[model samples]
Target: MSHASTAVQERPTPPGGPGAPESGLSSRSLPRLAPVGFAAVAIVLAVGLGLAAGWHSKVQWGMIAALFFLAISYAVTSVVENRRQAKDRLATSIVWVCFLIAVIPLVSLLWTTVSRGAERLDGYFLTHSMAGVLGSEASGGVYHALIGTLEQVGIATVISAPLGLLTAVYLVEYGKGSLAKAVTFFVDVMTGIPSIVAGLFILSIMLIFEIQPSGLMGALALTILMMPVVVRSTEEMLKLVPNELREASLALGIPKWRTILKVVLPTAIGGITTGVMLAIARIAGETAPIILLVFGSQLINANPFSGAQSSLPFYIYEQYKIGEAASYDRAWAAALVLIAFVMILNLVARGIARWKAPKTGR
Candidate 1:
């Protein structure tokens, strides 16, 4: 045979072909041991610390340290084996840390409130309306303040909701030119305006009209304070509605107003509701405006339009200022109640958001 022909017949096959060698990794892959190893070490360390210091002492710091180690291990493994994994692992760790940091204070507040406030949260506290229960008789509830809070805040919500929603729609959907820009700029400015300033504005308005300090004045002040937040939140939520949905509606010969009402609003309704609830929560606990505008009344005031009223915030302040141990306890209890109410509002917002979320699967 010729040399060339023999050479061709003797040539080796490609690496991955019929008689080729396998690549670096095997077909049956072993699970990466880094995470497992890290977890094992973390458990052992945590257990040893708990045994030495008692579980209660180790609960907070020990767990936090273990989580940090686990995150570091994941990061190291990712850098060694997978480039994309590194970024994702790092981001996940950061997000978790952020969540934990946010949750810690809230949990602490709630736990403390529940622990300390239980004494004053009884039926007597709810029924007597703060009439004559004095000097640590252990019988006064927050009925009057609760009523005042509900009525004044209810009025404020009614007054602010439509105005804020319309303002947001105009800004996001129809706003244009210098006027719109000016309105948006001012709204942003108003968002940072001091709560006391809002009170002063309402107070000045009342003074001009010869109206005395009253619950109505307080509601008006709160409405002013809350309106900007509502507008900002609602505008952001409305802006999140996809432009494609608007175009699709327009293509179907829907009027702009109808499209906003039926299509856009409904699509972004979850976020809008959540934002509104959050805005409400933000203002409900405000003491500055309410205290400045409304005189605190021990008796329950059903009418926000007429006389002085006492909301939880004002009640807390009033009780705190009395300088008695009993009054101080009452103030703490009121604080607990206010915090609970805000938490309930947040929970409700979350529920509404979940319920109103667009169905992804039929």
Candidate 2:
């Protein structure tokens, strides 16, 4: 019992408890009661309110009550656990709700359209033209419109794709002069111009040459509208191609044009195809230009250069304008068909792009 022993005795270790010096109570050990308490209270209140409101139906009010209870329960539990954590949970819940809100409308629209539109999308719809359709009865199918759409749009792609790709290549590879700048500015301006204006431009040009509005005129109008989109998308994709690839080709003594054809184009073909498909999708659905430039006809027109023709979009418009119930049904059906075709095209393009994308892994 010397001086050190006396000091230890004077300040002996306190008994282990809530106030213990060595066994201090954890902040967590405080009862997490508030969240559970609030949840229980909310449940009771919700039930009482539901009963008071006389919600008898199992399908309507029952579902509503259940969702309300679930939301409240989660909110209360999160709050009782931790305020900061609860805030995050609340934000996550809000985001999920927003997502569902957006997705539900699209789902509903698709469901409704498919349910109604399935009636008209049959074998007959694909094979027969609407040339014979007349009077009260919806007598024929949309084959003519489908054919015209493909032929006209096909010609448009033929016209626009090369021109667009070359222009983009020029912009990316060699055209950095004032003329290039001017071209870029004009493209930007063209992109913002209204679709109807493009149609009218083609129409005016045709009138100047004493040519009539026809599917070819429509194709030309669409080409003008689509080229800028193609140029913009292709330019972006080409820019993404590594400069290193270009330099390596140049180092091999490949001429610039050959390098572009053999090396650069191959590397970026996937993106280029995707961009082209996107441009096609953009123009394929355009109604104003085709309607203004290519007057609708019921009979199938094989040659775009000769006479007036129709497209799926204009077909839909024409069907709706007939003001008959059968016509309206056909319009919905045609819309569904158009959407399906576009979706198929996108899928095919994606598949081709993925299948042929340059393999980096050995």
Candidate 3:
């Protein structure tokens, strides 16, 4: 403490000489309401210019307002503060512009889907099947497709999740050298493999075997697409487990495999479960594989392994392609249902993760 005090006292004077004022804090700053004022002015200027030019596009006005807001913010900040502060404000403005640009299209899509789908979405629509409904009649529901989707996705999850978990454990815990490298290389490859490619690969196999279309075949294709995502996500979660935890477990006379099963897996289970759910969400909406393998059916097929089946994605596509008003309504309704299904899966995943999270002492 004495040495620190002495060193502080002995510190060299500034190049400006003794008693120079500190430069650590800003000498000037903008008012808190300056941004709001700038935005209001920007909006008015944009509207006035648009009106003078006889333009009717609100998008153009919004873009112009954004540009005016950014420019005015930078210019005013530079005058009130410094170039560096002005640059920071400009960067923040650019980020906001980019965020709005990304979000607008998503909001627009949701609004359109909900408005159109609400017309035909009801209990009768949800309970009946399209077995006897005509393209122009619009009196059927997606219950059959919903059943097929559930079965196919459930089968894929059953097949892929355990395999992915095992592969990730191997890579993290016991893997080394060329074999591990090859596995890692293939995993990265599979991560980017197109969904259609997986479908086509399964289709070729079916052609060779002369097998009929079934939901199990579609499930297999989905499994191929889902496994890599599970492996990548689980591997990342496992890597986050501290080596010290593993070492302490080993020091307590637990075998490595037992330690991994208990200490490591439980620690990472929440992330692992979430990743599996995300993979399920990704595969749940896939239409290509279902088209190539399941061969969409109008009547419900409870037996996935032997008969044709319909899935929600395929149902949406089939209805949309029919070129009738009723079909369009059904398509929109199916889209809304698909969206809700994915959203519910995500919510369930969050709940499971929270429930399984390790507790800590207060």
Model 1 misses residue 359 by how many Å? Answer: 5.4
The local lDDT score (0 to 100) that residue 141 gets in candidate 1 is 69
- Per-candidate TM-scores read 0.76, 0.79, 0.90
| Candidate 2 per-residue lDDT over residues 23-136, each given as its tens digit | 233233224564355446545665667678886654344345445545764566454444555555456545655665588779988998798889877888778778878724
lDDT (Cα) of model 3: 0.94
lDDT winner among the candidates? 3
- CA RMSD (A), model 1: 5.5
Give the better candidate number (2 or 3) by lDDT.
3
Task: Assess each prediction's global lDDT (C-alpha) against the native.
Answer: 0.79, 0.81, 0.94
In candidate 3, residue 98 scores what lDDT? Answer: 91
Evaluation by TM-score, superior candidate among 1 and 2:
2
Per-residue alpha-carbon lDDT of candidate 1 for residues 222-314, written as tens digits (9 for 90 to 100): 888888888999999998899999999999999999999998888888888888888788788888988878878878778878888888998
Candidate 1 ranges with C-alpha deviation above 4 Å = 1-95, 350-362
